[model samples]
Target chain A: MTPIVKPLIKTEALTKTYGSIIAVDNLDLEITEGEIFGFLGPNGAGKTTTCRILTTLTKPSSGHAFVSGFNVVEEPVKAKSGIGVVPQYLNVDGELSAYENLKLHGMLHGMEWGKMKMHIEKMLEFVQLSDRASSLVKTFSEGMKKRLMVARALLHEPKVLFLDEPTVGLDPQTRRNIWGIIRRINQERATIFLTTHYIEEAEVLCHRVGIIDYGRLIALDIPEQLLKRTGRFVVEMLDDDRSKARFFKNREDAGRFVASLDRDAIIRKSNLEDVFIKLTGRKVID
Target chain B: MVGTYAIFWREMVILRRRLIRVMASYAISPLLFLIAFGWGMGRSLQVEGMDYLTFMIPGLIALSSMSQTFSIAMDINISRFYWMTFEEFQTAPISSSSIVLGEVLSGMVRGMLASFIIFILAAAFGIRLNVNWALLLSVIFNTFMFASAAVITSMIVKSHADQASFNGFFIVPMSFLCGTFFPLSRFPEWAYLIAQVFPLTHASSCIRAAALGMDIPLISFLVMIIYSILFFLGAITCVKKASL
Candidate 1:
């Protein structure tokens, strides 16, 4: 038998409770190295809470998690060093310039002059904000701020990057630009763990995704596998009365066509949004 | 230690930018109080057989430094919680103890500067220092105790309203009852006992005694030292347990 490679990040029955409510409940996950793992959930669904636990910002109520094999609670400094987190809120120091933000981030990780300067420049360029590096963060657009945050996270070149809604509010172009940066980072062989409600983003960028609702992981698999798992064929039309009637009348015909078509053609039409609503009875925010 | 120094440096740089405003508000507040009390009411009443200015000046300096220290701490905490700029530092590798240490150290520095400024103004008013280096150290010790006590109060505060109301609950009470604005002998005997429960009274007694070149009680000195240590520990503990 071929040897198995250990996962870079793992959690065993990880749990966190706030007062009477459980923010994260018995979450067990194993993320292999060098893959973009999307944690899909609606707001208040424990995505940020789980990320906070993994980042060592808050301790779990019970159970344990590890980053790069270092326990989050026992070796928080090592775990923090191994993982980079970009929070959903813009936690950038608005008074500081873009370059100064990265410089401060490097200093926080104990990086000094020679290496700090090189890493700051490289990370800024990687985010395509090198030209605006000297401007104060308060002056930057929302897109620019998000990009700078990514650069700040990459300053120490963490082994695992955790981004919570990295593209919450931005133009389509800026969002695509961010996706490109994420892809480039994955190409460099870094493990990426990001939480997002954007189904298309997860479908396009993630090698694997975990759908969470009510603080529980309802589904976890590759996109294609998840699509195959949910009934192979879905003949959907507009929600108008005429479209609904047409869809119902042609359902049998569509099924026969799918059956007669290439055996490899699973003809699955369920988008991630549809799968999420079916699982949670809540709409995934566009 | 290096992380502590870095935090200190960052605070100093920020204060440097706002030096003029901080100076005018904190250091100058006590000077204006001294001028108003000394010249305004110097002839109105006899204060314990000594010049009223002599007794009131040390207390004002201590009060000013204490209030300034607490306000600075409260502002920092409020910003850390509400504005969330403190997340940057909290997420850093620096320990929680270092964060409180940096804040306490900076508060002490500011308190010392306020004391020194008041001392100069007193000199200009012909309130001779009696040239005792030991007395000077005692004044600084008392001032630091006052500042540390305020810092402790600020650290325990949970909300912006708590920060604002600290003056009503603590600062005003300390000022009026602990001989900052007047001698406690003027109050009823029961009131005097109530004032003694607060560490500020012992601190004011120590600094006031030393400033007039009078011998301070050994018990008062020890009590002030104890207050400083206790409040320092309390402040550090509060800060360490706080979440950013």
Candidate 2:
């Protein structure tokens, strides 16, 4: 097999601190080109901070990162040119129409009128917003606005796109629609770096998932590998009135039941939520 | 820059759609100030060669720029937080400098438009069109400078409550001490120092001096330039440090 290329983004001891609290701490990370990398963590686990630093939106307190072969601190504009970010909060101008927004964004990158018009039409169509191209964004539904946000981000044809909780407030159907758009971007060879708390979202969309807790990377691998390595099938039965005496009596039986199964399998209950709790020593808030 | 022009064009179109409200807001205060302050002062003793209305006309023009430009600054923040229009700028490839320039340029356009309307009203009231090219240029330069300063003010603001603080602490004080409603000669030494710190002082003095066809001091011009540079730098720094 051909050797895989080196990472497009590399970080060494990257840290961001806010006052007395550490937002992101001593993180070493690498993200390859043409791959969808998902960051999964509970709220306030520094997922957004990590994304902000990589996108050149916020400066890190210490250490450094490189994007598209340019250092974020030393060559921010070059690094910024290679990235497009869709923040958790909506940033679309309600006053401008869908076309106007895309046109302005394209112009910012110095695209010519002829090429911009053609590209704007194609992108609007790609996001299924062609019908409402002239409608004011303030009049758009949450889903429609979200789609336009994606279209605006893609106008510059950025090599890497960062999305922070892209589907946080959307309905399930809308969320799925956004997922489809993300997948399409991936197919077109744009590397995606998204931060999401939804495990199902990471499992469905990300090529590789990184689980961060307390500002540190705890697990980073394919979703299947994580479940396979740390999770087990759980057999839940009704609790009896036999109490502690019966519980001790059934210990041997439980051991035999576990011994009868495949060696690779363990008779234990564990899911993503369980894994999160086990690692963080706190119950998953949601 | 091309990006700044694009943003400026977009802002113009948005303002066009809200033309009725914008025009109404612009006309309301000048009319009220004309009827109330001018009439109230006219009933009393005559101050100088011109009527109270004529004296207040230039003041009204400067006030409109101050109020409108600062409000535009605040409006951008409100739109970013409540309506989410800021996302458009964030995802776009434009530099923060371009964003700041675009917004300030739009405010400058608005200020000039309102000031022109005040000039027309003053002419209708039999006030002379006292044209001093040098001083008029200074007034305009200061007006644009203050517009940029207002935008910088909004960039540093953390909440809606900051709007009141900005208006009460900065805008009101500057309007008073900067000679928007009175001449700079009436201000004391320390007050003059505080007044010179803002671009508005240069703006109001330049306009007032122009209306009377009086020569402005070279020191005022130098101070305005210094204030303009400081305010422009403040705006750039504010945008660079903004998290959202």
**Residue A170 in model 2: lDDT:** 98
Give the per-residue lDDT of model 2 (tens digit) for A99-131. 988887887777888989998999999999999
Candidate 2: Cα lDDT at A74: 77
Evaluated with TM-score, which candidate comes out highest? 2
Judge candidate 2 at residue B206 and give its lDDT. Answer: 67
lDDT of each residue in B105-168, candidate 2, tens digit only: 8887788767776777677656675766865676566666777787687777776788668788
Docking class of 1: acceptable
User: How many angstroms is residue A184 displaced in model 2 relative to the true structure, after the best TM-score fit?
Assistant: 1.0
Q: Which CAPRI quality tier does the interface of model 2 achieve?
A: medium
Clashing residue pairs in candidate 1, if any? none
Worst lDDT 10-window in candidate 2 chain B: B43-52
What does the lDDT read for residue B64 in candidate 2? 76
